[model samples]
Target: MQVIRNGFLSLLALGALTLEGHAQAVVAALECDFPAASTDDWNMAASTLQYYIDTARGWRVDEDSFSFDGTANIVVDGKDHVASLSITVSRQSGRANKTLRSEGRSLTVSGECRKMEASGRKF
Candidate 1:
């Protein structure tokens, strides 16, 4: 009876540990899209988004987007440009939604994906 109880408790502890590990998995990439924009516009928007993500601290360029371990803020300085943009990313899970406003235009993109593979030229 003692051995059986110990084994049961051990299994429960292992199961809880597994769940905790999965809950802390890092978000690998962000899937972004501009559905209403044209191909050229989408390309430009994706490029600008990538630029912002690249400039953020603790983030590394991963083909199209940026990858980071923890939470970070993406801030774009307007300078000679019209408007600036700011995006906050939390790497707790596979979920993200960010918006960029510039030159009287707003671009929104979302979805945290596993891989950084691009489907096509225009995002």
Candidate 2:
């Protein structure tokens, strides 16, 4: 059986990701301890609702059955400090691995992600 599959149930697989029971691609924020760059962060744009990071732009989130199904496989462009970031969150352990290829820097980050409050930060 494939663990969590879509909807709020999928959030159950990602311990760091949690919403108010309404999980249909909601705007959320990600804060991780990136040793390569502490300022590096991530968030799901409220407007595009697309996942992106602070390293640089040009990120295309691929659509697939695994998407929003416990594991998020994001494909990135061949440029920028954060070349690629793929997160496989499990209900037991939630962590983000970051690598800045330019400097050969790498680190593992862990933090909580919650539903972002609309309005002030809303796009």
Candidate closest to the true structure, highest TM-score: 1
lDDT of 1 by residue, 5-90 (tens): 01111211111123655542222333333222223232222331221233234545444434444322223342333333334444
| lDDT comparing candidate 1 with the true structure | 0.34
Error of 1 at 20 (Å): 34
lDDT of 2 by residue, 1-123 (tens): 111112121222121233776543432333222222232443221111212221112222332101131223322243323233334222233233322222333323433333233421122
TM-score of 1: 0.28
lDDT (C-alpha, whole model) for all candidates: 0.34, 0.27
Off by over 4 Å in 2: 1-25, 34-92, 103-123
